[model samples]
Target: MRRPPMISLFTGAMGLDLGFERVGFELRLTLDINKFVCETIRANRPDIPIICNDIRRVSTDDILRKAGLGVGGPVVITGGPPCQAYSTAGKRRSVNDTRPSRGGDLVFEFLRVIREAKPQFFVFENVTGLLSAAIRHISFYERMRKKEHEIPPDARLGTAFEKILEEFISTGYRVKWSVLNAADYGVPQARKRLFIVGSRDGVDIPFPPPPTHGRPDSLDVIMGRKKPWLTLKDAIWDLRNRRDLEYLPFPSWGKYLKYVPPGGSWVDIPRELQREAMGGAFYSQGGRRGFYRRLSWDKPSPTLVTSPTMKATCLCHPDQDRPLSVEEYARIQCFPDDWKFVGTTQEKYKMIGEAVPPPLAFAVAKCIMKAVKEDPGNPYSDPHLKFNF
Candidate 1:
């Protein structure tokens, strides 16, 4: 029998690993720095090995020795590293930015694992902000903290992405990348994420799979609306009828929502409420987009986060006054209702919010599968290739 391809999941938070699990990939090993997330992986699958700490702190030789992948272990590694430093919503600081460890260096840590394990394939996921990240050589450049965030006089685009590609190629793999929307798969959210997959040159590396659910049934693929995108109503209405459906009022923002209608937000509040609602931001630019932003029943959901209740990026229900519960957020991310997190509500939200929706993961996985199927031939253990820098 041809064995199922085993997957070693890194930074396997929120059981986004579970999505890959659902699609028949046997998860052989899981790694995470958070003990809770690691424990969740263990609790759910007591049989699988879970390494519960930073990869930098873990011994590569020890991990390989334990996984028994010394030789002939055909494996694929998948993970979504914390990407705040590179996030569009965050300060677009460089890899050396003192903000935190969630920058390109963490990704390089993942590459370190790839170099040591020599996995046949690996998948990396992150927010689309990577499309514009930059790179610099320290000797030729000024310090990062020279006062303000000033792009180098001649900085080119995709420098960060290309640097990431170079890291994977250094580990002996051919790499390709693309951004994907969750709604293209069966997930109801319009979450967009960048996916990069690297395979040993000439072995097989598939392009992303075409949309399975939202295929066009209409005019120009770009402009026309085929089946309209999935909406919050498509997700929670059934739960609404159930007595178990959960809802909690945010003492701060939930009350103000009482006056806003379905598909309406702070702008919809009466002139009095708008003034009261906006307060300081009344004169703020940028559309105050999420303020009292009621989700529309006719469109896909905005990207979910660890804290939907937070106003900076609210994810409130289109009709209900309360913010979407952990359950609804999980659903929006395509997690099974019973897929429990082993942490506080905030932690659970963080796990769920940070994950690349599984449907999206599976869609990308299938693309890699297609690439493998097309060319199963082996490549030289020692290969010759140069990057087009």
Candidate 2:
């Protein structure tokens, strides 16, 4: 059977596109705002049409024209917008910041294009924080001074998710979303992301299958139902022996990383050393587990950030006393060893960190392919099929 064609937006580094391609999806056109990312995509896949401009400047008409598709086509749209607005690790700005339009905000841009292109299926990927991000109105700030802190019923948690789902449902799509762990789906990292899958034909694609791997002592692994999660050693141990691979210098915090054994973090520092290593953060209340953290050869890596060497979310090597290298970052994200990324060290890290892990995307692509192949007319067989997010 012929695979579906896809029009990709926010196609950073083409990590998501690569996974879909692996499952036989044909990518028609790719769009992204970052010049460097676009360059990387072009360098790798020269034949694919690319639109390297702000998504706001491009119209649905432009996307269709470039993709050589009409209003109705077997196209699957996929992308993760700038996630800081919905990331719990960040300030959780929600809709407070301005974008192209209230309608053109990147999340809504995904919807707008879907409405205009009217594709048969669309997949939305984002940080899990979208599940609870409140959609605070501008007036909520002014009212904050007069009232005690509390979420208004209408503006409570999960409002952002509800609003997104409602828009898709109203536009004649059946949708379901799930939080997936990359480690479970064969990636050698513990990153978790939110995936929303929709079909204009109301064919409910079940959430990707149960995890295939986990911790050795985890119930499934011990019970013989699944394999243990991939370890950091599994992903990058070969690089440790290679003399040709370039590595980043040990961070200024290297001295502290040397003291953090595998599977350990800031808490392992002596009380006096903690003050010297973490400064004011040593006294902070919460367990800042990411601080001075070193990867364990026996476990999957932590979710990567754009910068691995930062003091807050230090991804120190297990025994090397340095940050993971750019090549290691690409490997963890499942990019081929030879896939070239074009940019400065930090820029390269940004591209790698922002990507959807290829194997995780592959699992999702496989699920969608199965549903499409079965041609389940009403895939949402359950009445309670909508995600409760």
Candidate 3:
């Protein structure tokens, strides 16, 4: 059987799309609103068509025309819409975010394209925070003053996701979703993301693809049920001495990062200097582990944020005093060495940090391919399987 063609939306850095391509999916067209992101895509994969405009302004007709497909085309649509609004790392604005770029509503736009394009299958990826996001956000101060019961249903955890699932279901697709860790798929990073797969023909997509990697001491690894997790040493040890390394200069507190041992953070500094290194953040709540943090050679990295030098989310190199280089960021995200990102250093980092690790995407694409190939003609045995979470 011919592999299905693919159309990608919000194709930041083409990481997910590249994975599908590796699995023999022909990437028909790609779309994104960011100029630099589109430029990066064109720079590396010039043969693929692109729609570089706001998804809201780009109609279903435009997408279909660019991909040369009619409605109900044998295509797989995949994307990770901008996830900041639903991200736990942020203020959890949820669907109420009113940024000029229409942050959260982009998910709905993804749904719109799915509804109109009617592809054979579609894959939606986002931060795992989507699972617990409320449709309406209530500030922490306001919530503290009010009883739990006083909060409206819209403000309740998971309400936003419930609505999203309902929207997918309403489009007549059989949907399956799960939160998957990239490290489980051998990406050398423990980035956990939410993935939703749907079939328009009512075929149940087998999801939560079995993990192929695990912690060294885990039962799965010890018993040879899975390979040991890949680590930073496995991903970037060769590049340690590379002359072309590109990275951001560390912040003011970076002077203290040298005292932090590999795998350690703010707490590792001397007690007397900890206050000075952390400053006002010293009194902040929550684990400020990212402060003065240094990477460990033996472990899978913590999730890659857009900026590795932020006081609250630092991703210092294990031995080097500076932040992880842009090349290192690409390596951790599993981008091919030759893949070119066309933008400023910061833009490159943002693209790499936000990408869905290709290894994880390949695993998902393979799972979907296996299901489709094994039972192409049959409807799903049970279309009502609740989401795997």
Candidate 4:
């Protein structure tokens, strides 16, 4: 009759832990390597236990002992170690990339706690790029055409993910994983991430509810009702008063923001600056869209990155020229207004953009609570669970 003991959040960043918190689950403990992030957590939710250290160094004993929970008591684990190493964006560099592949090693640390704490369910999130053909190399298509099955398992998402799932299954948990786009769930952004869910029972986990907003016609589908997806206008319309201060409002936003028009970019810049800004990239083939790109008020936003201050991954305001502000970034990512982020402004942007959208997390948590609240023997089920695009 008692509820699951608690959710032990690892790689807990910004509002991601808070997402689980919104669903009526008590945050017994939260962990992340960034001191500023822990500061943020402590600032906003002081009652929750937050361990601000590398997950690699923290043991399950530390979590259990710190939270005062008994061994084997019900505990749900959630978090995503630094996923850059496994990211599809960077060259399929292995350990040499150094931007946190070792962070991926911390996944093992998460599994270690699973063996000890035995939570009912947990979710592992990562970039969809990791699942791409890039895992073979930049020349992946070439290499495949040329033939090479010898790719290392850790180098790719499909293979590496299977291993991650297998480890959980071996530990007596049923697992399911799917790539989900945040916009589909109404986050006002086009963020796509991989969600891996596992249950202690062998019940195959279910996919997230289908998207609320229909897919774009250009992408696929006929008149899929549901008003046009949210646009940049819809996202940051209220932040216009700061126009003079708008040019690249921060260290990075200034340069890129100057060139990107409300619905324009490098193409809109003076021809000389265009050549200067692009360098040889101008001559390169393909739709160099990201460079000096403008936002469309009629469409959802592109994936929110850790640094909106950076122009290269521009999510420029539709009418305004500056990069999305920290608060604007949070709104697009679906964080509630009251959800305060700890740390400096830049850190605030990073944590919020890097988080799982609160609504998406809410959906996932509701699914998790089903297993926690229902009969584990029935696998996982919920009657009041809400589903949206």
Candidate 5:
């Protein structure tokens, strides 16, 4: 069967598109605002048509023309819009974020194209924080007040997600969404993301795609059906001795990292030096596990951030004193060894960090293809399925 053409938005590094392509989906056009990301895409897949303009300025007509498609075309649309506004790691401003540079409202641009192009299928991806985001952000201090209950429903938890879903539903698509961990899908990271899959024809896509890998002691692994989760050692051990590896130097506070054991963090620092290492963060209540954190050979990595040198989200190498190298980042994200990334080292890191891991994307594409091919007479029928893990 000829697979439907795919038009990708926010196509950073083409990690997601690569996975779709591996599953036989032909990518027709890719779009993104970042110049470096566009260069990377071109450097790797020069044949693909790419739009480097911001999505807000790029009309649906332009997208359709570039993809060589018409209204209601049998095409699949996929994108992970700018997610910082909904990311827990950042200020959860939701739709209230108006910074043009940040593009917090770009999710609506995605919705606009979906409505205009009327693609047969669409996949929306974002950080897991989207599930709990409020349309109007309530600061932690405000929430601590005795009158917090007086806050309007629109300002309460999950309102932002509800509003997003309403917008998608209004476009006449049957949507099914779930939170999935990339490790469960065989990616060597414990990243969890939200995926919303929709069908214009009301065909329900079977979701929470079955796990291909599990914890070493999990039932599925014990039963000999699923493989054990891929580990940091499995992903980047070969690159350890490479002399040409590129990585950022640690910040001054990272001097304390030497005392941190593999898989440990600031908590492992000597009691006398812990306060000096963490500074004000030492008084912070949360686990603060990312501080001076070192990857463990036996475990999957923590989610890759834009930079490994940040004080709060360090991605230090297990045995080495330095951060994970650029090559190691690509490996953990399942980018092929030959994949060419454009721009400076930091640009490459940002692109790789923001990408959906290819292995996880491949798993999703496989399930989506299965749904597209199967008879729709008896669909999965569940309108919403949330995975527990």
Candidate 6:
């Protein structure tokens, strides 16, 4: 069983890389554009080479040099490109915005690195929004401004997944993709992400490891087949007495959060107060469940966002009126107790929030390792053998 080395790009906080490292994958090099995140990596994992440069400017040769490996070496590459463009919360701009070359477009750079590195296996992770977001020539507002008559069919282009699959297949890899929830892999948050695993050697591309924990009424849990999901209390109960844990000052929204009960949100606020707290969004349609929401000790947390104190998406502590502390954020992301973050409170929160949960990444890595080691032959050789998950 050969353990492959890994090159991690967009390595925010090194959370994903940490998971791989736990499962015996060697961390050879880490790349990230954020200097603060690079410092954080250096502050924690000093032995791994850190390349704090933009991925667009990085070449395959540069990465190979840093990793001390030759081309076509046995290696696994992992990264989650910026996902804001494809995020459902915002306007889905596939490729038209032209702001820093557009959102979701950075996956191209990820692919470029993969092709250049020519790794044996690779893992690509991102928010679920990547599945349906289509490449666009312009924003909807811009299209309205143009007053374009008879919009052509090509105006809306291939979906992000379609484009990604095309590229992966063209690169001579067998690809398998699935949407995985972090809580299912023992993370204390219900963070859902899309994972694409590809193998260059015709190996059966593996899916996520099976769920070890599930919601109370989930079929597996109901049948006594899996453990119940871990909760906020499970992840942060010990920190309750640890006053030294660093935290950002509660946002103004904390006032309204006081009215929110465990497992509650802005709706828990008095109607009159809701108007004052939520302002114009109070009248907006749809459930604004995230606003001033408090964590429920019994349930897995909502997806951890970049800012726990933001008015629109608060992660108020289960018992306290404040947002989750930076230490709590790291714990929920499955980062070890001694793993330190570098920067101001807000910067630290951003780094932790953007990270892939270490537990989930470990599960994915185990699947990849099994596939590469036990099933290196093409899936077509045994059509009955498929990714059951």
TM-score of each: 0.84, 0.89, 0.95, 0.82, 0.94, 0.89
lDDT accuracy of residue 121 in candidate 6? 89
lDDT of 5: 0.87
State each model's CA lDDT, in order: 0.67, 0.80, 0.87, 0.65, 0.87, 0.81
Supply the TM-score for candidate 3: 0.95
Count of backbone clashes, every candidate in sequence: 2, 2, 0, 9, 0, 0
Q: Residues 1-389, candidate 1, lDDT per residue (tens digit)? A: 23335545455554456666665556666778777788777767788777777776887676666665653364577877777767766456645443335655778777777777777777888888777776642321354444335656324446777777677677768777788888877678878889888886546565676665563444433455335456667876676545554444565756778777776777777787776677788886674777776677767788886677766566677666778877787778877777767787777778778887877777776655555444535331212322111
Query: Global CA lDDT of candidate 2, please?
Result: 0.80
TM-score (C-alpha) between model 2 and the true structure: 0.89
lDDT of 5 by residue, 1-389 (tens): 45668899999999899999987788999999999999999999999999999898888998999888888764589999978888888567888886765556888989999999998789889998888889998886686673757887878988899999899888889888889999999899999999999988876677769888999999889999899999999999988899899888997877898999999988899999999999999998884878898989999999999989998989999999999989999999999999999989999899999999998898888777666656343233223433332
Residue lDDT tens for model 4, 53-166 = 776677778888777776765446787766666665434542234344335565667788887887767777767754552222334554455434565554443555555667
Model 2 ranges off by over 4 Å = 99-104, 137-149, 152-155, 247-251, 376-389
User: Which residue window of length 10 is worst by lDDT in model 4?
Assistant: 244-253
Residue pairs with backbone overlap in model 3: none
Ranking of predictions according to lDDT: 3, 5, 6, 2, 1, 4
Error of 1 at 191 (Å): 0.7
lDDT of 6 by residue, 4-93 (tens): 688898999988987888877888899888888999999998898989988888888998899988887646899988777777675777
Displacement of residue 382 (Cα, Å) in model 4 is: 9.2
- Once fitted onto the true fold, the runs of candidate 6 whose alpha carbons sit more than 4 angstroms away are 97-103, 137-158, 375-389
Per-residue accuracy of model 2 over 294-382 as CA lDDT, tens digit each:
88898889999988888887888777777888899999888998898988888899899999988888888877666665563423223
